[model samples]
Target: MTASESMATDRPDDLPLPPGPNSYPVVGNTLGFLRDPFAFYDSLDDYGDVVSYSVAGEEFCTLLHPDYVEQVLVTEESKFGKSDFVQDAGERFVGNGLFASEGEFWRRQRTLIQPAFYRERIESYTEPMVEFAADAANSWIDGETVRIDEVMKRLTLRILSKALFDLDIRNQQSAIRDAVNAINEKGDAGSVDAFLPDWVPTATNRQFRRATDQFDDVIGTLIEKRRGDPPGDDFLSILLHATDERGEGMSDKTLRDEMATFLFAGHETTALALTYCWYLLATNPGVRGKLNDELDSVLDGDTPTMADLRDLKYTDKVVTEALRLYPPAYVVFRQTKEDVNVGGYRIPAGTSLTFPQFLIHTDDRWYDDPDEFRPERWTPEFENSLPDYAYFPFGGGPRHCIGMRFANAEIRIVLATIARRIEFDRVAGGDLDLRMGTTLEPTDPIEMTVVKR
Candidate 1:
């Protein structure tokens, strides 16, 4: 039966929603949501695993349990799709790219683009990721404080541009970064004005539009130029020639969306992961020592290769643990396509359901001390003992982030390359605010002093 037909109900009122806070009329829980959406969702654990809440007038249920998450994102995925709110907000910047698209369109795009991120192709990016990270490390002066976030962002952007598109966006980096920041702020759940209509033409909205247009102009030109040139090895070249089973390649507009998607997804989250990784390392000296030990033993003072990275087990654990605490994409939202009972709550069709990685990763049931940065916790025994959905930093199911493998490799390469060459410590007394934006970014500049080792 079809999704709607299966969900057809006789007494819709009989379905009971999970318990939650009493919301005010009209505004609902807008105030609480505006105060802090991530915290608001966290508070729902006090009510129940599946609890109802509202933002503006719309009803949303937050799912905290891993079992519930499994059902929503994996087992019964066909009965759910990307949240309308996410699409509405994400499209402002990413357009109908993989991050925003749904249904058959998303599937087709995934098919065409999946090859660009394959293990073999992603392995090729290791050299550039290492080179860029090394360049950033070399540029830093000993004993001089620098904003680590800015450093990572620049390194990641340079790597992404060269490795993915084979284009140098150094000149356009500031404008592109600003555009991404604007979209992130506007799209954030904590932004009270996030629900504002698109036609309103607010200042933030105008900036968002301008940024996207600027990105489009740049990407459009790249596409037009690449269309006539001989195919190269970068993702753009692969995309230029990529054809489906029907033997048709992506159109110019589709190519633009995918390029924008890569620009945002490729650079943004990895930058945050590297930033947080450095923060974790600086704060935990013992962990840093262990990471360095593994690097030294494995590399013997040389740069890491793709094959050598496998033996850098402790380094991988560091990346995994940091992602657990500060997942770049902290939450995944889905809209139910049909009536479904999950965790004993009957969720109606068209309801928004959230699976928050931040909450799941921190749950004490699966973790010994969830807040602690312990790379050793990621061993095979622990991984085997835990639930799959309990630690999904890269999301889960078929719709999980396609670049996860690529990202894993990139983060490891960058970390190993920089760590072997320099010693950096987080400056004392700088505010470490974990900003909730399109991706989880630092609210305050993460200042650190770098010294050549």
Candidate 2:
């Protein structure tokens, strides 16, 4: 037999999966965790770094340790491939776009779209991002209680709708939010709905179906409008008019999928990141004060210009450290297509591997006082030695976030705009219970009293 088979059969009779805590005959940790995922993970050590858990007979190993994560995310990424959850979700909404595709199809899409994120193209969006942020911040009620989470959510929504698509989702906001709300509400309702491969008449299924349709409608209209009258400047017009060196262009359906991919994937992740950023800043007075000082000294209470973002050094570090503490997309999964050796464990191909970024970000093994939100950790000196795969707030390798440059500029500018204008008092009962979904979140909505600075 081959070496890969040797490891799979290496399971001794007494070793139940040989990696994680022992299961209770068949149930695993299913009933034990409808809540408190952090505690669930903390208790998994009884089984070790690689362990098996069967959720309704679909068993996948939960991975621990940073070394194995690197193998999955960096070295053997192409083979491992994104799991079905993303594909199923994408196909249901946007058809077979980049996020929904793999192999040559996904690769071609990536190459075609890469220029849209070129430094010059991204730099152009900075003005719009700052403008939207300024309008949102102006409506904040000074010294009055504000749902900071809602404000940031709107800010990201506007940025995604207007700036990214150059069209407003505000018109379709109700349809979109309702669908996302249901998706979240039915939390962990099993991966069964995804496996159906077709929609059903169930209320939850209906909601998702309607939301995706509405999203497609919005994207479809935008694509058509841009195709007719190209703006020659914005993203939509660029995508509509883009031609290959050979004069080839994307199909109409392909254009729709790409736009949907950006719309669906980009907005929520950014909202979660901003929410956590505000919470961290509210709790840590010293960090908040220091950041405010940086904003005041550099931005001087003006809306951060595209040029100002270049000079806003500390703000980048702050957002970087915040992402480390609370990465928007907490876990990345890849299913091994062929047998692979990883972090000293040899396993047969088809093994599902998880790289829990949340664990790595908080673990002391990689960082000094990992829990502490020290923006200085990303200093020029320290940043040099930091591992490439270790601090990926936007992920890394070929599938890294496309709009990372845009996101960094957007977040820093918005944070500075809000920071220099107002201060937050943390809610006495502010509870940040992380919900493990598309993005982790504070279980309690963030309510804070904002005072004009």
Candidate 3:
């Protein structure tokens, strides 16, 4: 008999799944999962690397080890697909865009849009990133308290607009921002929506529908306007003209869906990342001092350009380390396509897979003094020594985030520009706690005072 068959036969059918928390009849672990999903996942670390649980009759398994994560994300990606719950929730906001689409459609869209983020294309946006960041910094009252989270959100939105669309929608910024926030706020907090039907037209549902329409109208108008205008180097222009191997261009709806996906996905994660970065810098003066020293030597207090990015090594390490601790997208969801064995555990088809980046990133096995903020630990030698899946702030495998390079460039440039021109001090007391939503963000306002240099 084959070893695979032998192992499978030896494992009892009713041996009970990997150890997990006991659940109330029928509802399963729904209450525990909803109370605090991140904390619940963290608690599973003590259970074992592979822990199983069921919610409302649905089965799930959380993979903690990097090797197991790699099996699901990279080596065995074909055996799985994006979770249906996540895809359904995402489609409510992003439509059938790349964020929600699967199979051949996703592959084709990814191919057509890939060129917009090429090295040359991304490098072209550096000047605007620095300019917008400087404009934001200059607008702040030096001695007064500024809501750094809002500041980063507005700055990133502007940068994504200028960098990707090459147009200004400042007049519509507030409305668009509100619409996005409403959709995110109403999403089944922490856990995916299983109990509530979106069609019920509750106040939040009506608001979500109205907000989605407003966002769609704005994006649709921009698409029409670009059709008649002279060809430009913006991302919109690239998407408009792109042709697949069969020379077929995307339809208007497809264009709108992808644009919305980029606008939504592009800004929020980066904004939260920058927000957390500032919080870290404020609390850790030594790391901030080293960062400022690098900036001073690199640019001599001038605006940074694409050429300066290579010289900003420590700046890169700081951003990398921040992402390690507080990845904006804390959890990734996938569902099995067929029965599979992950690390000797048999999982049936349609089982939900949760890969917690927040947990894997802080595993003491990979990082020494994991809780401590140490940028210097991310040296070339140390980074090379780690496994690929061990540090995936942007995710792994073929379906990883397409704009990783673009986001990194924007974060480094913006962080350097601001850090060079201003210093920040922590104003809020007590340990800063995280609030889970569409992305992981601080529960309380991260109030900080900016000291202009």
Candidate 4:
């Protein structure tokens, strides 16, 4: 049925399921989705805003319209819960941390964790953000090729480790990086390995287990060391001392989970954002020129401080545009907790729903030349004219990413700081072949030659 026709019906019982592609007998749409998720999701827009499909007998829906996205993420969020895939996969690595937990426990954890990302607390991280960006920029020899993705991941991880844990984890970065890679590979949404039970002995599972073990060893030692010492001012210290209305704090296990979540989600998303921003800049010289002009005029070769952010308008726009094109958290998944009507169709309880930011951000209805890298399109007037969920990279509602403010500030600062000293020239033939992972990742390394500006 058409969306309008479905919506005209008042009774949930009278609504029909959203239209979707025909599924195979047993595998459903699994092979098609796994073959190329981006293409698969893009094809759904042809069906309708709300489209239904299945994978291995599990029913799923994709909400393409921004209003439907708002209903699921904001207005009627409580009626939905974190999808089992997210909870099950995430818990294996991050434990019952904010990203995986549900119900009252999730609320309490959010309340306790909220203080770490307060404006004042985030502002304190600016020094480290700029310092790390500067360090990474200086270390790159002019005309030398670097893998932009790896560079960003390391730089962001160092910044986050210092800001969140109050430790310089340069020595431990290799192990942490390996663990994150292994976890992401195993947790990838379209991977067959993702659906397999953890108890099953497989090569991927073995690597995943070893990686998690190494991760636990590193984080466990840090937590234990911090517990015996006097409290300090980093995120770890804040979480350690933070008490609820009941005057209780998190246990060691909870602390480990929170640490793991912050370390992975906090750093990885920002890194990918920056990586894509650099890639976009290298390819679109006009935007890169405008960005360089802003950095030059604002900071004038000096490292950017938190105070310099307001004047870095174009730099911010470049970051915004990059995020629009390559949102690291490409899609968000949620499961229905009760029967609900969305866009005139009934979504039954326990159905998996996907809201693809990548799809919505590039829809022709919301953007002109949606695939083009045009930072100029992000004027304040233009921004105000769009639907709210159309541009949400960090998500929305009560469960919006706690690290949003922190990430925005960091992206602008790092982009400004590094751009002031260096420029990247894209290596010929280095195009990003996108892959859907725990976050959006390039199938091949993103290589670029560094040049002193």
Query: Weakest 10 consecutive residues, lDDT, candidate 3?
Result: 1-10
Worst 10 residues of 2 by lDDT: 2-11
lDDT of 2 at 240: 71
Q: How many residue pairs clash in each candidate?
A: 0, 4, 0, 0
- Clashing pairs for predicted structure model 4, backbone only: none
Model 1 agreement with the true structure over 1-453: per-residue lDDT tens digits = 322233344444466777899899888888988887667776888987778878876779888878778877887789898988878777767778888888888888899888888888888888888777777777788899999888888888888888767966666686667766777768776675578766578888888778788877877888898998888879989999999888999899888888888888888899999999999999999998888788888999888889988898889889999999999998898998887777656888888888889888999988998999899888899999997789888888989989998889999999999998787888886656775777887778889988777
Worst 10 residues of 1 by lDDT: 1-10
Which candidate has the highest lDDT of all?
4
RMSD of 4: 1.6
TM-score of each: 0.95, 0.89, 0.94, 0.97
Which portions of model 4 miss their true places by more than 4 Å?
Answer: 1-9
Candidate 1: which stretches are off by over 4 Å? Answer: 1-14
Error of 1 at 79 (Å): 0.4
Clashing pairs in 3: none
lDDT of 3 by residue, 22-92 (tens): 77888888788888876777789787777889865678888888887887888779999998767766776
CA lDDT of 372 in candidate 2? 89
lDDT score, residue 185, model 2? 42
